[model samples]
Target chain A: MAGYQDLVLRVNLTTGKVATESLNKEWARDFLGGKGLGIKYLYEEVGPGVEALSPENKLIFMTGPFTGTIVPCSGKLGIITKSPLNGYILDCSIGGSAAVEIKRAGYDAVIVEGKSDYPVYLLIEDGQVELKEAGDYWGLCCHDTEEKLKKVYGDDYSVLSIGPAGENLVAYACITSDLYRQAGRGGVGAVMGSKMLKAVVVKGTGAVRAADAKKLMDVTYNAYKNDLLTDTNLWAYTDGTPMIVELSQTTGILPTRNFQQGTFDQFANIKSEAVAAAREAKKGCVSCGLGCGNFTRVGEAVVEGPEYETLSIAGSNCGINDLGAIVKFNANCDAFGLDTISAGGTIAFAMEMTEKGIYDFGIRFGDADKYVELPELIAKREGLGAELALGAKKLAEKYGGIEFAMQVKGLEFPGYDPRGAWGMGLAYATAPRGACHMSAWPVADEAYGEGNPFTIEGKAEMVKDLQHYNAAKFSLILCDFWALSFDIMAEMLSALLGEEVTAQSLEQAGERIFNLARLFNTREGLSAKDDVLPARIHRHPLATGSTEGKTLPEEEFIKMLLEYYSIRGWDNNGVPSGEKLQELGLR
Target chain B: MIIIELRGPLARYGCEHGEKGRIEAKADNGVTVRQILNQVPIPLQHVGLIVVNGKKGSLQTMLSEGDSVVIFPVVAGG
Candidate 1:
């Protein structure tokens, strides 16, 4: 417990009560922190059958042991809740100083439950906590709200605020912090809105104490110099995520035209070089040395990024090649606190439905003029926005075209077209939060690395190992950009916590956390049937590019899924076995 | 002569002639892709993907005259 804050803050908005309790040390030992710890809390506290956007739901904010320390890229705050979009467990990591601020304020986690009668925001300054009326800031955009809060609380305070997308209860609404950083998936902001809470502001003056400062510093400095600053990790600083646009393009996984094609002819117009051409500045999250954030400006639009996901999902997938339009769309989404992936995916699905004569939303692919205006509409839930706000899953259910809806578990797919990367399809289908690229990116090894992109052979084990690795890595709250191995992670944790941590133990913890999440999903009525890709992926082959004439055959996908389940010690139904749970100490 | 293309940050290892990201290498009929890579100053560990004539290739892949090769660094992001 040397690295932990050893405290949990509980707030009841309806009754206007605030209290602090000791963190469960046993759970901390098993879950580590961040995503793992937060999910464990959610699984235990928020039982099954609770509606996501109701007062019965709970929102938990958590930070890892590495947070507030000298650990590099350790400033991620995990927001765990039931997703209003899909009624599933959702945990989103947001990069900013909020995690550090929360840890410095002497707590490992903050849990908010029940609903407030009026609009309010939780303000925490060291030992002091208050729920202040936020009626004045209710209707403001995320950027303006943060600015207003900073002006009132001084610049030292970090604010996490939701825009109109959350206030209006958009299913894919996101929570924005530090203006551009967001917990951007699965209606986390809607959960906040459902609680009638607008923002959480914090200022902490205390410092985190490392168990063995000398050893921790030495190990961290060594990794920072030898591993992090090397060519393997330097791409984040030189090009950031925009560099991946070309990688995904070359691998035939660019996800063009609502994933109907694997390649985009206009990819050059929105690639990393294009972003670099319009780049005005570079930014990074707290304690970050890589500084992967690219602050771009085109025409009058400015935003921290149209990161690779935004570029591929909103730009090429929508058939809009105009970088300026994508930049404006990115700014709009950031201002309105929308998940750009879901927004773009929903619009792209509509475009395809209209083109195919299934339904007409008066939008077409490559309509950049109309595309840029959608975030405001969707946030306000007006006219076309009302339909778009329902997200891709609901839209497909309402109209026809469920085959091309391009979502898994009601969450929209990210930039990768899984047909090109077979292992990536498995990663998406089995991801706990649904279609989440962050869960496990097998594309790196298959499409982007030396491994064959179009094969299922050896893919099951690869995906399983990668998922476990990412689970542990995110629990430590390190940036995914680091690409450091498990050995490095174990060394750092061992030094920081004064415990004999090993790569094997960390992996076991990851497996435990992953299984616990699966159990939570099973208890909520999800089974192997829920873990599936859309018909477009299984039935339709991409028409052109390196992946031309390729489809992840349904039979092949089933084989891969069974193999993955077996590897994870799960039953054929994708439920963790009693023995497996006991092995991970879950039972 | 075989044409070699570098992408993204690997463009720094491009040859002196042709374009900024392109290189022309004289390769024997039996030369492996590893041999051609060894002839350049590019870091082998940093190479994530190797494409030969638009198809995925490996270090053991044999090279021939007029072959086109593209090399890129490991790509990872969320």
Candidate 2:
């Protein structure tokens, strides 16, 4: 454990136990860390048949060897647990000081198990751990709770906390970090809440020692320089992802009005220019070279993101085009600790339900002024928000509007309208995390020529390859944004770990994680049937947008799934076969 | 004559936002996005996305009048 401290901190809330364990080196080598290691621990500790929100579930927080190092965008952490929404393996990564602080606190990972008899929060400082009473903090939103913790602790302590949404166990609740960053999707926060843990406050002044500091710095600096020169990447860093509003709208892939159409004419209202114009300031993650996070000021309020997904789902998808409202919604999701994508998706489903006469509300598209009240109601799980909190899959199931749920595997689709870009649809269907856009963003190819997005010419190959690559990047705790190319990542890995990890090796590591996740899902009874997109994307053709009249044919989906499974060495039903498991050393 | 629109950083050198301006060129050798960039004296490589008529295209994509083109840089991460 030269690069790693070989330590994992374990907390049993029920018994008020705080202990440390040596790293399982064999598992470490095979699974790596972050997502890979987290999943390994989760699979071993929690049975698949256990209810996601039950006391039997465990939440594992992890950081990779590269985390806290000079590796660019290595400041990321993964919160792994069983998902209440998808009922499958859930691992969500987020940027902030949390992962770096955790690593510096002298542990590569932290596993919290069993429910506490009372509300509590974990505090860690240089390996010292404590379970503090959280009775006064239980019902507060994430922003207030974070502020209260910072006041009691210190501003330097990195905090991860949940809001009423998680405490209420809203299926799509997210864990909030560093004000606006989130380990969003799959109800990680709800799992945390179920354990009666309000937050994890961490402060660490320790440093991450690379095997070769000089090499690591040189490689990291080289990446920083390269990223500065990348055009699209520069845009992302400057305007944030919301800069894609115009592009997505123009392409008709913005997922408007809950996938009723892909394009929105009011996209200009939420474009990056509008957002940047409204911004009061900007910021980014710890040690991040590019400062991309936008903090906008409209009236007296401040907010983050409205990023592409939030703007699409909350704005165009719900027909609320006002940038101010979208920004406010994003901030609400952060303060209240909700996943903006899921929140937006759920709200959009409700709007569509209202439109179709299945349900009635005065809601209409582009009515940003009115939607402002929705998040507050949703966070408290009151009125229509209560039903919306059930998540799009459950809502659609209840309301007989399943065709327009715009979800896959029970998780709602993100901002990208899959109708225009077919690779994204495939990516969503096969993503281990369920309907996640980042698992593989093939739209970069189809939309911008990073690869061939439309042809499906090499899509099966591209999708499988990218999925593993993303998993590896996540494991290494690097931002998938800055790890744009494999060559750069291989250099970073080799430099930091003093190992010659080639692009092929990195891809192999990603494959290992992917298959391990599939095994977890299989053990949970998920099958090829669980891997699917909403009917709108596969059955009903869109009448407008760049992909007008184009729907991903079901046969193509089946073919792509088959190719993807085969590429990953999985069985015909998308489960990891025994030989494949052994190949990844997971067996 | 053909026109294209620049966005984000690339918009700094452009005449207008979403405005169309024609560049004279031969039919078969119609000015590519690259040639247009050369004439405009802007850094084309800084562009992360080039959409021609709402389809993801590149600088190698030839320009044509009546084509609503938008060139942008990368703007978001996971």
Candidate 3:
């Protein structure tokens, strides 16, 4: 407990009461922190088959030992909850100053349970907590809500709030934090909306201490000085993720026109140089040496990045590549508290659906002007937005075009086209929360000519390894861009916890965490059958591009699955085996 | 002449481009990406993605007549 506060705060909206509980030391040791600890508590508390957006389900916001510490890029909090969109366990880690604020608030995790009779917001400062009436703020957009809250509670306070999208229960509604950052994907915001919770405003003046402060400082500053400011990482440091616009474009994996194409012709207009032209300033999270977040101005409105995902989903995926307009779309999604990935994906699906006569509307693939109305409508669940609120999976099921739905396990795909990049295909099909790139972005080795993306030779094993690595990283609550090796993480953990830990031990815990997640999902009625790619991925061969005529053959998928299962010690159907459970100490 | 384009940071190594990422080089039949890159001033390690005629090609892949090549820096993501 040297590095940890060893405390978890629980708020019950039903009774309007608050309580603090001691952390389970053994479980904390085994699971590490952040998502691992959060899910462990979630599994024990929630029922075997509880409704995702019900009073019985709990929403957890957790931080790792490394969080709020001197470690570079350590400012991340893992949000874990039952997903209303996918009907599965969902974990989305939001980065920025908010996470470090949570850690400094002196709680390892915050759990919200039960439903309030009226709309409410939770305020936590130092060790004090309260539930306040949110009557006046219920209907405002995220931008307005943040502005209002910051004005009321000094500018020093960090706020995480949901907008109209969450208020109306848009399935993929996101929680906006640090103004522009989000705990997006799999409807984390909708679950909050279901509980009648509007926001969590936090401020902490307390300090986060490490066990060996001197050693930690030496290691931390060394990493900050040397590793972060490299020529290799210069692109990310300068242009942020939109730097990948050209990577996805030239590599022929940009998800364009609803994944009907892998390359966008107007890619240059949306790439980094174009985005940098509009960037007025840059910002970083607490303790971050390298800033990947840019404060970009698109005409009259100044907002944070419409990152690669936003650019692709709203711009190229819709067959519109106007950078300024994409930035506007990003700001709109942020204000409405919508997941740009799912929102843009859903919009594209609608566009394609309309093209196929499923519904007659002005929503077209290449029309950026008309799509402006869609985000507001979707947030309010009005007219065509009601059906679109079901996300691509359920919408495709109800209308038609199940084949073209850009979703897996009810969650929409990110910006990568599985048709062009096959590693992403396996990663998408098997991702715990559905098709998320953050699960394992092997594009470094897969699509960008570092390895054979077209082959299944060792992809299953590669994915298995990367998944375990990311699982551990998520548990540690580190940013994906931290790019720290396991050895450094082990050292950091060992120093913080005042214990001896090896890189191998951390990796083993990662494997254990993933298996437990599988066990949770299995009990939640998920199985290997649910781990599937949309038919469009298997049926529609790309007519042009680097991945021309490439489709994942059923046999290849089965073969890869079998190998993946073998590596994870799972059965033929992707269930973790008894021996595997025992080996990971989960039995 | 062989058509080659250097994008973003890689364009500094390229000379005389009317476009943002365009570069032109003397033609050689069945030239590989490595051969064309050897002639460019940028270090081979600094170069990451190499695309030939809209298709991803490696250092060993041979380029034919009328093929357009695009060279990019070592950045991969999203």
Cα misplacement distance, residue A65 of candidate 2 (Å):
1.3
Largest TM-score belongs to which candidate?
A: 1
Give lDDT tens digits, candidate 2, residues A25-137.
87877677889889888888888789988888889999898877776667889889988876789999878889999988999999998899999999999879999999999
Which candidate number has the best DockQ?
1
lDDT of 3 by residue, A417-498 (tens): 8766777888998888898997788787777757877778888888888888888988987777766678888887878777
TM-score computed on alpha carbons, candidate 3: 0.94
For each candidate, report its DockQ versus the true two-chain complex: 0.50, 0.41, 0.35
lDDT of each: 0.90, 0.80, 0.83
Candidate 2's displacement at residue A309, Å, is 0.6
Give the per-residue lDDT of model 1 (tens digit) for A1-587. Answer: 68898899999999999999999999988999989999999999999999998899999999998999898989899899988877788999999899999999988899999999999999999889999999999989999999999999999999999999999999989999998898998889999998989999998888877889999999999999988886677788878888888788877999899999998999999998899999989899999989999999998999999899999999999999999999999999999989999999999999999999999999999999999999999999998999999999899999989999999999999999989999999999999999999889999988888788888999999988888888898898889999888899999999999988999999998888888888889999999999999999999989887899999999999999999999888999999999999999999
TM-score of chain B of each: 0.87, 0.68, 0.80
lDDT of 1 at A451: 82
The parts of candidate 2 lying over 4 Å away from their true place are A227-229, A450-454, B1-4, B9-29, B40-48, B52-68, B74-78
How many Å off is the CA of B2 in candidate 2?
A: 6.0
C-alpha lDDT of residue A98 in model 3: 77
lDDT of 3: 0.83
Among these predicted structures, which one has the highest lDDT?
A: 1
